[model samples]
Target: MDYRQRRRIKVWGKAEYVEGDSALIERLRIPGYPAKVERAILFHVEALSENCSQHIPIRYSATEVEAMMAPLVARIEELEQKFVGE
Candidate 1:
């Protein structure tokens, strides 16, 4: 999923805003797989979640395990941006 989001993504004139990031509607191309999987992810950071939901269940997705710490990431970035302007 992360690979699909980072490497290549396609949105058919539609997009979803998630976790301060744009979730581009994309389909994963897996050879030999008869199904085209649709997935999304956080671009700049990750998604943190203690309570599971439909979109994000389990602990984390591919790319990294600390994805469940998205809140922390956003907070850290927010503080950094506020303290240091770049």
Candidate 2:
């Protein structure tokens, strides 16, 4: 249709987690900025239910990465609401 309408996306993750002997030992990541933005957490754990941020990464700690991904994430969400009917 239009250029703007054609250029929208969704935030998807080829994400993963790394578990050790400890309770909080996993991660969630997405292609962020020009690199990968890593999020360490307990994503699917039930007993201690709900997601807990381990060491708690600042959402926009890396300036370059945050700057790059900020617009991308926003566009993706916008596209989701527009196209995916989310």
Candidate 3:
């Protein structure tokens, strides 16, 4: 069976737009960049339903993903070393 099919989850909620706090906005602002987010949206969940996982995508842990990319990272490093030597 597909991975996503193993788990099904649904969430129902009400969305509310709240004014952003000045301190939070300032903290989130990047230096030298204009502020973009002026407000925040909050979701008040009313219900959660778990039906099926058929639509969910498979997810890997950090370690698992790192292992998968180890060969590529090693190849890049080897190429960098060769480039530096030439």
Candidate 4:
């Protein structure tokens, strides 16, 4: 989910607000295979400066991503509970 905040990301002499960023994973199953093939998707945040460009890929392993996202997820949940009065 993208947070609607006044955070700006600058690139190549131009600046743009951070639209959003999300993590995704891909898995595939093969015929007669005993296990599913899994892959971690690597992607760069895109921005339009002089032209459309991509930032450095988030090159993190699955475990690392989970560890990094935990606090953020908990914070979001806490905020949600507060907003809904739960």
Best by TM-score: 3
lDDT of 4 at 16: 38
The sequence of per-residue lDDT tens digits that candidate 4 reaches over residues 57-83 is 335568888999999999999999999
Query: What global local distance difference test value does model 2 have?
Result: 0.48
The sequence of per-residue lDDT tens digits that candidate 3 reaches over residues 1-86 is: 33533675678999987675877667656788765778766689999988666567787778989999999999999999999999
Q: What are the root-mean-square deviations of the candidates from the true structure over C-alphas? A: 20.8, 20.9, 12.0, 18.9
Cα lDDT, all candidates = 0.49, 0.48, 0.78, 0.51
Question: What TM-score goes with each of the models?
Answer: 0.24, 0.25, 0.39, 0.32
Root-mean-square deviation of Cα positions for candidate 3 versus the true structure, in angstroms: 12.0
lDDT of 1: 0.49
Off by over 4 Å in 1: 1-64
Write one digit per residue (lDDT tens) for candidate 2, span 53-78: 44334443477688889899999999
Task: Please tell me which model should have the higher lDDT, number 1 or number 3.
Answer: 3
By the lDDT metric, which is better: model 2 or model 3? 3
Estimate the overall C-alpha local distance difference test score of candidate 3.
0.78
User: Judged by TM-score relative to the true structure, which candidate is superior, 2 or 4?
Assistant: 4
Q: Which candidate gets the maximum lDDT versus the true structure?
A: 3
